[model samples]
Target: MNIAPRYLGRGSWLARRDPRVLIVGLALFVFSVIQVWDLRILVGLALVAAVYYRSARIPFHSVRLQWAYIVFFVSFIVLANTILTGGDLRDVKSQALHVYFRMPLLNTPLSAESTSYAMAQYLRFLSMAAVGFPIAFAVAPGDIGPAFARLGVPDKFAYALDLTFRFIPSLAADMRATIDAQRIRGYEWEKKGRGPIGKLTRTVPLLVPVTVNAIVGAEDTIDAMDLRAFGTGRRSWLRELAMDRTDRLVLAGFGLLLLAVTAASLTGLTRLWVPPFLLPA
Candidate 1:
């Protein structure tokens, strides 16, 4: 609900860097995190993620909203995998909050080892998500649009990216308004039922009016841009980005950190898929 335009977000480190480097560096960080999952490697990644959000001027509250779904999704997968694990059923049970379960038609005892493996995989995913999301968060759509086009991203694709940035905030804002309107009409999200369907039932109604309003807003935006001859020619950027010395320094440091992670991971200095310490029987 705390939606605002992409480029208009508060200042941060990545935002201040030239869009070209921001784009390229983001790609590098993502690739590295996906391929490498050493705790040591992720130690640096965590720093990069933190620095990116800090530099981009993104508010902590805004960053939290942007990342809540990812955290929730990863946590959910971990829980499911933990319960269904064939080897260890209780690997992460203590850490996990109770989420209602749906009974399968077939009866089978999940193994602890399988569950442990699944939990490890889930943890790996979470590590990567924790590292990569902030970079994604810092990437402003306006910068991405032109930067991609310059890098040979098709104009159509670039436009799609641009539109994605434009839509996120506008849509979020619209939904917030919808919720407020519904609240006035005696709707309360907390009062909704507990099941997954309950969530869908409660949320789906808010979207109907929000979606319509979004469409109307989009039409108005298009009309306004058309009046201003928005795409009649070259796309000029509102944020003037030029790579500076600080950008070079930060990038070089991250590059070294990435190399260290790769080395540590391959050499067995950091292990990501290892289960947490368990008490001996």
Candidate 2:
């Protein structure tokens, strides 16, 4: 099925940047986004995220499945938030709210303030996903470890991160193979169950073989590392990464952005903004 997230091999602006720039910039962007609940600021951030994501030139077809998953997850969270606590009432500046309608059965009042809060939450998550997805779908697999190593991450941790990225696709491939084998043996995953227990039981067929393969893979990796005397002494990366002028400029820009966002948040300039319509006159 080729469902794993792999580099799209596109020669786009973001792809041209150093991997470290993307990693550090993404962290700064995430931190900045999480500091505010204002819809205006969040809208601006979401636009920036959209631009950043577009710069990677990732085709929609390549990541449609991932997009579907993200949309479903985010929608579920927003719906649950609306149903449960009525959407973070703390962010509403005024105690009084204009009730729009009451949710059936739950009788939860769907007020304008709560609706706006849910919109803010939705934008918050979408913005994060926007800038974050490029890292997985754009960066070259070979560069991950060296980039992290160059960033002063410990050698073992750097290598582990590299392995982690590559492992996901490998694991997915293994799972797909296992599923295919099961299907050949007359197993139907969809027809196996109906409820939560059915779902759990259905996974058993896929999980067991995949899990055993993963354990074997891990042992093989360990043996290979031992043969190469890994972690015994100072480790050297096969690939060398150096920051260019563009990379330096990007890092400085990211640093300044983080500082500016922190100042704005601490100075209370980025407080949640409730729509005037939501307040009773």
Error of 1 at 265 (Å): 7.3
lDDT of 1: 0.60
lDDT to native, each model = 0.60, 0.84
Q: How many backbone clashes does candidate 1 have?
A: 17
Q: Write the per-residue lDDT of candidate 1 for residues 1-281, one digit (tens) a residue.
A: 35554453336555556666666666666665655534445555666666564556656565665568777887787667554542234323533422223236533334333444444555456555544454455556657677777667766577777788778876887788788889998888878458888877888779778877777768877887789887678666565556679877766765776677677667866543333442113
TM-score of each model, paired residue for residue: 0.60, 0.89
| Clashing pairs for predicted structure model 2, backbone only | none
Off by over 4 Å in 2: 91-94, 192-195, 276-281
Model 1 worst lDDT run, 10 consecutive residues = 94-103
For model 2, what is the alpha-carbon lDDT of residue 218?
A: 97
lDDT of 1 at 219: 85
- Maximum-lDDT candidate: 2
